[model samples]
Target: MANAASGMAVHDECKLKFLELKTKRTHRFIVFKIEEKQKQVIVEKVGDPTRSYEDFTASLPADECRYAVYDFDFVTEENCQKSRIFFIAWSPDTSRVRSKMIYASSKDRFKRELDGIQVDLQATDPTEMGLDVIKSRAS
Candidate 1:
């Protein structure tokens, strides 16, 4: 489906892969990129379930805008194991202004397609969405 604001269509594979991650924990994280020429969002990479959060973060480009989803597993104060799905909007400070604007405008629509996201994070730098931040939010 195409988002009205940016006229960016999401590829079918995007949702399919997300469903695998959400329901079966098939992936640790999924990175998505906007293909301006195609005017669509496409799956850039899929991290293995054994991958660390640091590996997921490393998948994002140093100076680009992208979107990602991560399945975070953590233990509660009561020692209960739980998981939270996070939708991340990544717009680095060094990215092009046009790219940032496009991502910002289309973020909500794109995120809505993923049915089970529990936490929403917007990060311009790595520090903003650090492990501590995710852990705190998951708690």
Candidate 2:
């Protein structure tokens, strides 16, 4: 199939690389970035649940990192959970407001699998989600 946005046909070679991104089933948590239009899933990562909620990247002088979680099971079309995403760039005195979020939807979680489906707040991103799944596969 062709990518609707880029109009680039996903070749057999491209799919082989995508297959490498597959996450094996495990007791761990998994995250998937699914392109609804393309029906292609980019399995992100799997990680320890206890270690997923916090930041572990080397603190950079320019780029900052933070996370957010969205649960579709407990979310409704009208009312929703309020959440925040912070990306404090630079130092303590010169940080930039990178990204922010006050709400999350179940629709966002529908495409990904995580431990205890409904409570994935600790599994911040797809990479963490993938880690959890990979861990499950190992055991």
Candidate 3:
């Protein structure tokens, strides 16, 4: 589907992979990027189910804007195991203004395609979406 505001169509694989992650736990996270040439949002990477959160963070480019979804599992204060699906908007400070604008404009529509996200995070640096922040949000 395409968003009128951003004029970006989300690649079919993006939603398909997200379904596998959300329902089958086939992946720990999925990273997406906007293909300026194609005017489409495409899946850039998929973290294996056993991958750590650090691996997910590392998959992102240092000077780019991307969208990602992470399946976070944690033990709660009540001693229960829980999971939260996070929609992350990653726009590092070093990215170009045009790239940032494209991602910012397309984020909501892209997120809406992934129906099960439980948390929304906007991160400009590692500190913003660090494990500590995720842990806090999970609880």
Candidate 4:
């Protein structure tokens, strides 16, 4: 596929890496960055995120980090109870400072937005940022 705005073909080799989300089930997160001027996409892994919201909040810088609980979920499957929470943290004007933490469930929650862009603020989220999904099962 091509980026219509730049008339540039989005290459397959651009995919970089994957991150295994430390959720109840087998979940993974992928990252990608597209530089239209550079004609390149960089991919990478996110690793296991902090399972506790408190630890995550405590680690962030008070003045520089912005946080939000995008949404929450109560999962009941096969006698297993798990809570999936969607959230985000970003630094407004800083480099390498944006994150959209989400979960995978087969249900709808609600609609949300950040920085003028619609985000997946639901359990069974349907959203993507840039070319991150180009090399994943979601793609």
Tell how far residue 34 is off in model 3, in angstroms: 0.5
lDDT (10s digit) by residue, model 4, range 60-128: 343332223321223344655544334443332333332221111101121121122123322112133
Which of candidates 1 and 4 is the stronger one according to TM-score? 1
Name the TM-score of candidate 3.
0.98
Candidate 3 structure quality by residue, lDDT tens digits, 1-139 = 5789999999999999999999999999999999999999999999998999999999999999999999999998899999999999999999999999999999989888889999999999999999999999877
lDDT for position 23 in model 2: 30
For candidate 4, the TM-score is 0.30
| Alpha-carbon shift of residue 110 in model 2 (angstroms) | 2.2
Per-residue lDDT tens digits for candidate 2, residues 1-139, read 4344433232243233223323322212223333335544343333332333322222122222222222211223466643221111112222333221211222232323222222323223344434344333222
The C-alpha TM-scores of every prediction are 0.98, 0.24, 0.98, 0.30
* Per-residue lDDT over 19-94 for candidate 1, one digit per residue giving the tens place of the 0 to 100 score: 9999999999999999999999999999989999999999999999999999999999999999999999999999
CA lDDT of 101 in candidate 2?
21
User: Quick one: ranking by TM-score, best first?
Assistant: 1, 3, 4, 2
Query: With candidate 1 superimposed using the best TM-score fit, by how many Å does residue 121's alpha carbon deviate from the native?
Result: 0.2
Q: Which stretches of candidate 1 lie over 4 Å from their true place?
A: none
lDDT of each: 0.95, 0.28, 0.94, 0.29
